[model samples]
Target: MLEDVFRDQWGRVLATLVGILGDIELAEDAAQEAFALASERWPRDGEPDNPTAWLITTARNRAIDRLRRDRTLARKTEQMGRELRDRPEDTMDDTTKLPDERLELLFACCHPALALEAQVALTLRTLGGLSTDDVAAAFLVPFETMSKRLSRAKRKIRAAGIPFAVPPAHVLPERLDAVLAVIYLVFNQGWGAGRVDLATEAIRLGQVLATLMPDESEVLALLALMLLNDSRRHARMRDDEIVLLDDQDRSLWNEQQIADGRSLLERATALRGSGPYVLQAAIADLHIRQPRDWEQIALLYGELGRITRSPVVELNRAIAVGEIAGPDAALELLEALDLGDYRYFHSTRADVLRRLGRDDEARLAYGRALELTAAGPEQRFLAMRVAELLPPGDRE
Candidate 1:
């Protein structure tokens, strides 16, 4: 119950307070205090009739007190008062208002002035509705480290006088990629890491971006990419074990999300030139479509490689190449690609070698993959793949 409430109301609480405080750092602190209050009161008073409004009201009241307590908070308090007085009462429950607020928050957190890591941390912290602990856990870092990173990021945002509003019209296009990347990481944190709520948080951001930047084809493309990949969440795991794409049960795929992704991708492509996201969406589209075939999918991966010019794209391309061109052909490309630094590079190459009757080479690749990888789910999965390659009669 608490989890659901936090997921849905946390963003609103932060948004409302940020609007009032006009300071991201102070607003976040105020929001945290409001949650602390909820933790203490909810079990006793029971959930509020209008939980969101209750949270907003509670946050506003708390901000008022905070402002009084600290001389530095006075400007924010007056700003909040003006904003509250000028807006309609319905603004408290306004869906439109929240999206715009979040959009602003997203852009602010991902401002180019900050380092990439700081941008990711701030986006996950402010917009993800995630705690410092959760952020630390996601990156497998210590709590203190995550907290310091966030604190440093907040300081930089304030010091640099980063604009809280979205970039100007002429600069929006230039900033769109970073914004999309921030959103993409949010979705990955949730969907890729099995944090469903975080994934939902990411989708919500994408939806807001799509609505706010309707004419920006890439924005719509990002939404399509997230929905397409997210639609497979059901079949991605079973009994705490991960399921590879080819092995997943197609029936578990959500038809609605797939249709939504396809529509968005089609529109995005027709409106503008293809981008890394649009290409990725196209790759996912091929995977989800009925009567799935490896050949057509391989070609999409190739296109994705061209669009992104990323080694990661090349790594994925190797997988498709393994399927259509045979392991020998794939091996030729994979061996030459300088992806050994990446964990999946060795793991994927191992899989290709295993399929090509090169047992010793496969084992060597898996060993290198294991050595390079951090111990995690992906590492364990790679280890299992290694075990599968052992001589059947000699295997346990």
Candidate 2:
């Protein structure tokens, strides 16, 4: 129970402290101190009826004490002290205020001035409530490297005086894409690495964004896209192996989530949103149907590709084109793409070559994909294909 509460409320507590104290390091320290106090006192004093409120009050008090102890720090934190002094008596009692601060923290972490990698790491640490070690593991970076990166990002935020608030409406559209990209990256990491907790955290962040920016069509579409994709989580793998989408057990898909995603997509479309997310959600919607319209999927991918000019989108479109125009056409289209380092591109090429009875080329493509991919299930699948393509005498 305590762990669950901490997981859910840690970001809120940290966000509120950062907003009030205007110091990321100070806020983190105070929040950690508050949690440490909770671990000791909650067991003895009985857990507070409102654990979140209790945490905020405790962390705020800790920050005040620390500020007072350091005379030099006192001058620097004067504004923070004043803000705390003037805060409404019931402010700590109101849990809703924490989420508002979390939104502010999200925007601050995703500030355009910060490097994109720093923005992603900082957001995952601060807003996603992930430990530095966890963030490092998620991104496949060394712990010390991630820690230094996070420290640098926080220092930059403080030195640059980046406001802890969402961007103004006029500037939001420009800034919003970075924030959404960070969230989507987080979701994609979870999806690719088979981490359910990370995926859920990303979805939670999406919901928060949707609630904060209800009228933003792209925000709605992003949430819809995540829900639609996550609906297949159960069917994505079996026996610790990757299951192809077509072979997945349809009964395992989350129907409720699919329904919610469809409704959200409808809302986005009603808003005349033809953004990449809305288009992707529309494609995912088609995928859930019994007989997917490959031509329509290909068209939507083309639209998305035209808008974003992403090679990845074009690669996906080629797969859809294969469904509509046969493997040869798909292979021809794919050969025009420059995704030499992308494992999936090679994997797709291998599939198309095998379909066209080009065993030698299929074997080579499968080998390239196997060499590029680190995923165990994907490597297994590719190796199986390579073996199947080899001559009977070379089966060993």
For each candidate, the alpha-carbon lDDT, in order, equals 0.79, 0.88
> Which regions of candidate 2 are displaced past 4 Å?
79-83, 86-91, 96-99, 191-196, 392-396
Writing each residue's lDDT as its tens digit, candidate 2 over 1-396 gives: 877778788888898888778888999999999999998999899999888889988999888887767777646476667668777768778676554588889899999999989998898888777889888887788899999999999999989998898889999887998899988888887653323366777888898788878888899999999999999999999997889889999999999999999999999999999998999999999988878899899999999999999999999999999999999899999999999999999999999999999999898999899999986887998888888988899887
- lDDT (10s digit) by residue, model 1, range 1-396: 887788667765686667666778878877777788988999998988777776776776676666666666457566666665566667666444543377677788888989888898888788777788887777777889999999998898778888778788888876888999888876776544433366777788788678777777888889999999999999988776789887899899898999998999998989874777877888888877657677877777888778667888878777877777788888888887887688789888888889888989999999999999877666788888888888898688
Off by over 4 Å in 1: 1-6, 29-99, 140-142, 190-197, 239-242, 293-295, 374-396
Query: Which has the greatest TM-score?
Result: 2
- Candidate 1 versus the native: TM-score? 0.78
Give the best candidate by lDDT. Answer: 2
Model 2 residue 334 lDDT? 97
Give the Cα error of residue 346 in candidate 2, in Å. 2.1
Summing lDDT over every window of 10 consecutive residues in candidate 2, give the lowest-scoring window. 190-199
